[model samples]
Target: MNYSLFAKVFVAVIVIQSFIILIGGQLNIIRVDRLIQQREYEYDRKDMLVVQDAYNHKLKQIRTNVLSLFFDSTQSESILEKIKRYKGTTKAEDLTLQAEIQQFLQSMAYTDESIRSILFVRNSDEQKFAFVRYFDPSLLPNFESMISLKEDEFVKVYPVDASPTKQVLIFILKVNDPNTVGMKQTVGNLVVSIDTGFLQIEGDPLHADSIIELKNSNGTIRMSGNSFAADISQIDLDARKHDSKDYFVTQVDNTVDDMVFTMLISKKQLKQSLFAMKKNQWMTIVAIVFLNVFIAFYISRALSKRVNTVTRNMRKYTPGEFVNPILIQKQDEFTVLEETYNQLILKLSEFIQKEYVMEIKSKEAELQLLHSQVNPHFLSNMLEILRMQAIKENNLNLSDTIYQLSEIFRWNIRNKETVVTLYEELYYIEYYLKLQQFRFPKLQFRIVLPQNLQNQRIVKFSVQPIVENVFKHAMNKGKETDIHIQVIEAYDSIRVSVKDNGKGMVADDLDLLILKMQKPLADTKDTPSVGLMNVHARLQLIFGEPHGLEVQSQIGEGTKVILHIPKNEVGP
Candidate 1:
């Protein structure tokens, strides 16, 4: 073996494999980095939603308080009576009334922060002039549009001078009086401020930078607050454009569609961490590339040598030649490959022999065609004519004999199969016996066939020659010759015997007959004596030598031809 070529090719393959793995590792690292960043973005978006949900929850709490006060008829009536009683009181009396109003405000303060500011508003200067002059009306923003002069509830945005630098979210509520239920009369307006800052601060622990901003439909900021910002709108905008972090917006329905609540992540730390992750991932990828290269090189070198040896052996193996021994130097995957290849080589030789056998059979069939002895159509016509003549003479026995002879000639000429059933062989003998009876009706013939013989098959025309031999030789001189055909079924064989009380041969003559059957004699014309040769030849062809015909005789007594046929040869 040329180790040098194998070593050089193996080294080159290893190098190429290592290079491919290194490139693949680099691409994998980039993909992993991007995937991590995407996951972080998704997580941050969920966090922003959580923060916005908390803000909405706090606002819902505030709205609940406002609804309770708006629906409280008794408290509303009290506030209305105070406004009516103190409308035209003196400054000193109004001072006493202011004390009562302060106490009333204190009682309602716990309901919500928005409910503490309440004032009566009237356009009339003379009727309610004294109480109106005590407070700075110019300081309060417009509440006339909000007070339901006809019904009892209206909402208005009133800019407060208390926080004139910014803005206040206020709602105006009126208490209804039974006497003025269907009249256009306004007594006072209830004012309250929605604390946007407290809402954003509710869930600050979950959000990195929590912001809540209420904006009007026109995009003007109505309320803005955060743990860190007087103005959260800019940070909120940044959160929207980059929605890499979580951000969400909701509508505040208390004020017309005028207000929207937004919660957003407004810090850079979360993104900074993700960026640092990419840097660390690049460094990790470098180390991974080196490790993969080392592994790919080692694995490729080991795998290629074994694979190449199996390939060479497979390519060199040829059918119809003895297979070479595969030298397995290592007991691993290589050993399996070598063993499988060896099995394939052995199987190839067997297939070749089977194909060759089929080829020889094809050639032998051609030879049988050239050696045919009789004209089939002539033989058939002769047998049929003989059968008809025998029938006209009232000789049914002779007619059946001719029919049997025709069947024998037909079976032999066709030679459709090498084997026939034992029943078929018996039928052949029946015709031969009928012919013998016609020749000498005084000859008594008895046939005893075992029932088991019907299921068994034997070589074609097996019994014809033995029966023919008895008719020809034994019946030549006897006046009352008896022929007995007995078929006995043994354990693994069927025994067929034909016995005749005629002039039997001596031992020496029997031996000579057996020898002649074993080997062909020179004269074909005199060869049909017992047709023992022909019968023996066919038995050997169908079954084998150990199962051919046997003959026994005693001079001046009888002769018996015993055929031992193997039962296994019948069906299979």
Candidate 2:
């Protein structure tokens, strides 16, 4: 009853638990942060790839349009006439022709702001004229490459001016004209430049200070955008590295072997919020630790006091004092235990007194039942008197029935033992069937049992009561009853099943009858099927569980009752 030991154990356990929790919490915070960063990176990669794919598709479209222009010129047999209309007349150049040309150039820009400029290089002038989206007609950058173009070509990435920061990608097409018969002549070249900024994609977890860049086959960056600059060669795939004072770098290779996308992230800007989160979590941990210690101390003291109180009450309690329980006011384990202990003592006393009285009454009731068992002999003796009188009249069938009835009583009266040879029981059943046939002339019965198993023993009255019960219900509407009895010797057990073709019971009533057969001897007192219940209980007593009467019946078909008994446990 020394609760100091319990207090010491509680304190030690709580201290160990607190240390483990602290270590686990720190590790958890680190792991959770890494997972968050990983998820952010995954989302960023998807968004960046979306932008890359869409941008590539747009560039392909622009190339297709330029090729269409070339194809159109080849079909125009009067291409020289159209050119002369624009080039030959000064009023045509100032008004109708120039406006039409400018309108076509503007249409090439479409709604995409990334297409900064469009140009038509005559190859005859070696000078290029361009129409920018916002500015007036100006010379396009990287127009020098237009001189050598014979077929369609995608040019290398071009810088805007001296600075290679804001780059543009260009495609050039070689145009042909069909003005001269039997000859195809080269016409002006068509060139389109796309601004790189339009390829940038921004999404959640992708920082503004993060740069996304794509590199082509020559290791030169084809596209770069956002607040930071990134070198494709400096970044490695599946690796994080510091690139410069302003950025951290990572990159991944695309499906194209030579192309890769790289990102430059500002380290401080990306991790500042995470750092703040770690600080708050650390503060929360400290508070939790204090709360845990206070709770552990309070619980330890309260449990120690409850243990002392229980110990004192138990020591002071005597037999008579069980009337008043050891009471604890708080609704906790100790309170429940004390109340249950007192209630248990009270119930135990009551149960013991009731059981004592019931045992004596049960013994007395059993003796009275044994005395009451004499009633059947009076009926048997009357049948004996009838047989004597039938013998006097020389009526053989009447005498034979009386003789069979006498045999049944003799078998019942003989030792009142639970078992008889299988042959003896079958013989009595045959005699009983004769009496039943005399009673019901149309009823027929069949018995199927192996000759070798006839000498085996079974519960004496088990088969008789089942047949009697069947006959009782089997006479429904006076329809002829056909009874089939199968006594088969199985692998580990013996089965005696009685199946009758008669008006069988509905499910609810059949359930009640099966329930009676299943009950233990002590539970069958109130049920109406005493004879069958007695047989079922005896089989269970002799052969153990699952060795008893089984009932099966349907509303119109028939009823089947199988008596299951262990072969080894029954007869020799």
The alpha-carbon RMSD values of the candidates against the true structure, listed in the order shown, are 34.7, 24.7
Clashes of each: 2, 0
Q: What TM-scores do the predictions have? A: 0.33, 0.44
> lDDT per residue, candidate 2, 354-382, as tens digits?
56645654575466547756866887889
Model 1 weakest 10-residue run by lDDT: 126-135
The TM-score that candidate 2 achieves is 0.44
The residue pairs found clashing in candidate 1 are: 45-246, 114-192
Best by TM-score: 2
lDDT by candidate, in order shown: 0.59, 0.66
Q: Which 10 successive residues of model 2 have the least lDDT summed?
A: 154-163
lDDT of prediction 1: 0.59
Question: Candidate 2, 2: how far from true, in Å?
Answer: 38
